[model samples]
Target: MMADDGGCGRCCFSFVLTSGLSALFLWLSLRTYKPSLFIQDLYVPGLNSRNNHTIFFQLTLRNQMKDKGVGYANISLSFLYNSTLLVANHTLPAFYQGHAKTAHRKDSVNAAALPWPPSNGTVSFRVRAATRVRSKIMLWFTKSHALVVAADVEVGASGEKVKKKSIKLKSGVADPGSRWLRMGVANAMLFAVFIF
Candidate 1:
């Protein structure tokens, strides 16, 4: 009878331990927050003509997690004319963002001197930004998520401030290729953890 009671206690303890770990992992997964990117402003600072001009822009990053922060490994921004011609490109400096904080960065790019002027009064281009970010939840778990955001922007050669519009890109919508790959890898890791 004593042996039976001991076995029952061990089984109960095992069940409780497994349930607690599962609950903890589920909570962490649900609470994890992803960072977002937004283009605050874009305009031409000074230009005698459209031939040779410099474009200045402001970018903002908002961290959604209240207790977690993100560390950036690399960030690359590129501007393309008509989705083919590369107009300007800039590599932003690496930085860290605190939880629930917004970081604003100002950057400029000199448009390449074209042999011929643009036919229209406004030039349209796409802005593409790729970033590698590492997110940490409290002090326990850390994960890496890759984010790529792109938007079509038009600027008037007349130096008019581009219409004030907030262009914000979220993770899964902007770059599905990398997001899917990451999801697969994460699932594999989780399977390995739980199985082994």
Candidate 2:
């Protein structure tokens, strides 16, 4: 009877240990992990001015997850022109989150003179980032997100402004006929001249 009681006690101890391990594993699996966003590249095409400059905004985001589950990330970009502010583009990516791992991404944009007022052109701009932590979960594996970015800037005028002009002829010149008719007659005359 003593031996039988000892065996039963050992069995009960092992059962409690197994139950505790299972609960811990489940808790870790459902844990949530959040990430970040980044800008990668920026370029300017129509930039040309001495006092005006083109700016390229580059950004990057990095998130290391401690759990494995679906995660969401959002990044919003805004530019400050002189004293005014304008919202640029934004991006979002979703992936799995895991422990001791990182994920990354990037975005880029070129900012110049907008069509609004302030034509005198003392315009300057800067880029900023806003990030958030969405909900996360744990799974059989781990996932991560990392964001990266780079920007190229050029300062100067856009280019030479060309003015339209109206041409005037001497008053004694005869009026020319329709352009289509003149073109047809010229082509016919050229053909005749060449054939003859």
TM-score to native of every candidate shown: 0.69, 0.36
Worst 10 residues of 2 by lDDT: 161-170
lDDT of the structure predicted as candidate 1: 0.70
Model 2 C-alpha lDDT per residue in residues 143-191, reported as the tens digit of each score: 4333222121212233212112211111221222233346655765675
Q: RMSD of each candidate?
A: 5.4, 30.7
Question: After superposing candidate 2, which stretches have Cα over 4 Å from the reference?
Answer: 36-55, 62-74, 78-128, 133-196
Q: What Cα-based lDDT does every candidate model obtain? A: 0.70, 0.41
Candidate 1 residue spans exceeding 4 A from truth:
1-26, 29-31, 45-48, 115-120, 170-196
Residue pairs with backbone atoms closer than 3 Å in model 1 (clashes)? none
Q: In order, how many clashes per candidate?
A: 0, 40
Native-to-model Cα distance after best TM-score fit, residue 151 in candidate 2, in Å: 15
The RMSD (Cα, Å) of candidate 1 is: 5.4
